[model samples]
Target: MTFSIVGRCPETGQLGIAISSSSIAVGARCPWARAGVGVVATQNVTLPALGPQVLDLLEHDQLEPAAAVERALNANGWSEYRQVTTIDAQGRTAFFTGKEALGVHHALAGEQCVAAGNMLASIEVTAAMVHAFENAAGLLADRLLAAMHAATDAGGEAGPVHSAALKIVGDHTWPIADLRVDWADEDPIGQLDTLWQAYRPQMQDYLTRALNPTLAPSYGVPGDE
Candidate 1:
C-alpha cells in the first residue's frame, strides 16, 4: 500500500521521488534516483532491484523512459506483480501497473511528473498528486512535497501511512536531499515536510563543507566561531 511521485526539474536537470506507504522503511526500499541520469519508484509487491535495473538501462543503453521501463520489466519474471514508474533526465515519463495490482490503482502523468498509487482510498489520489506537482512553485523538491501532501488530501492508501520519504539528486552522485521517516505513528507526511523546511536553508552549507571546508558556513554549535 503505497503512493508515490517521480519527477524531474527540466530547468535544473534534477530528479526526485516523494513517497509514503503503509509499509515500513519505504524510503530505503521504494525510491531510487541518480544525478543526471533518472529516477524510479518500485512498489506494489516492491521489487527494489528493478529500480536500479531501470537506471542501468537508462544510463548504459541511453534508453528513454519508456524503453528503460519496458526492458527492466521484461528482465523480471514477476512483471505482473510489480508497479513501477520511470523518468529520465530529459523529464520523459513512463509507468507500468501490473495485472496483480492491489486494491485500486491509479497512475497519472503531468508535464515532467508521474504519480501512482495502489491500495488507495480512491483512484483519484494519483491524479490530484500529479496536478499539484505540475502547478507547485519553487524547486523540484517543493513540487514533490506538494505532490505528497496532495496525495494525502485526495485520499492516501487504504490504511494509515506509517513511513514517508523524499529522495532528490542534483549535480552530485549522492542524493543532495534524502529525507525519511522510517516509521511514524501519526502524520509522517507532515513530519517529512518539517524536515524539509529545516534542511532546505542549510542544504548549500553542507554541500560547501563537503566540497571546500574553507568556504563552508559555521557549524553554529560549539566554541569555534
Candidate 2:
C-alpha cells in the first residue's frame, strides 16, 4: 500500500523519488535512481530487484523508460502483481499497474515525472501528486516534497502510512539526498521534510568534504577544535 513520484528536474537534470507507504522501510524497497540515468519506483507487491533492473537498462542498454519497463516485466513471472513507474534522463516516462495490483490503483505520466499508487484512498491521489510536482517551485527536493504533501492532501493511502522516503541523485554516483522515516505513528512526510530542511544546508559541504577534505569547512562538532 504505497504512493510515489519519480521525476527529473528539467533545469538541473537531477533525478529523484518521494514515496510513502503503510509498510515499513519503503525507501529500501521502492525508490531507486542513478545519476544521469533515471528514477524508478516499484510497489504493490514490490519486486525490489525490478528497480535496479530497470535502471541498468536505462543506463547501459540505451533503453527508454517504456522499453526498459517492458523488459523488466517480461523477465518476471509475477509481473501482474507489481506496480512500477519510471522516468528516463531525457524525461521520457512509463508506468504500469498490474491487473493484480491492490485496490484503487492508478498511474500518471507527466512532463518529467511519473506517479503511481496502489491501495489508495482514491485514484486522484496520483494525479494530485503529478500536478503538484509540475507546478511546485524551489529545488527538486522541495518540489518532490510538495508532491508528497499533495498526495496526502488528496487522500493518501487507503490506510495510515507509517513510512516515507525522499531520495535525489545529481551528477555524482552518490545521492545528494537520501532521507527516510522507517516507521512513524504520526506524520512521516512532515518528519521527512524536517530532515530535508536540516540536511539542505550541509549537502554541499558533505560533497566538498568527499571531493576535497582540505577545502571543506570545519566539521563543527564538539571535538573538532
Q: lDDT (CA) for every model shown?
A: 0.93, 0.93
lDDT of 1 by residue, 1-225 (tens): 999999999898999999999988999999999999999999999989999999999999999988888898898879998999989998889999999999999888889999999999999999899899999999999999999998899978889999999999999998899999999999999999999999999888888888997897777789646
Clashing pairs in 2: none
TM-score of every model versus the real structure: 0.97, 0.98
Q: After superposition, how far is residue 64 of candidate 1 from its true place, in Å?
A: 1.3
How much lDDT does candidate 2 score?
0.93
Q: List the residue pairs that clash in candidate 1.
A: none
lDDT per residue as tens, model 2, 1-225: 999999999899999999999999999999999999999999999899999999999999999888999999999869899999999889899998889999999999887888899999999998999999999999999999999999999999988999999999999999999999999998999999999999999999889988997877886788653
Q: Report lDDT (Cα) of residue 24, candidate 1.
A: 89
**Model 1 alpha-carbon drift over 4 Å, by segment:** 222-225
- Give candidate 1's TM-score: 0.97
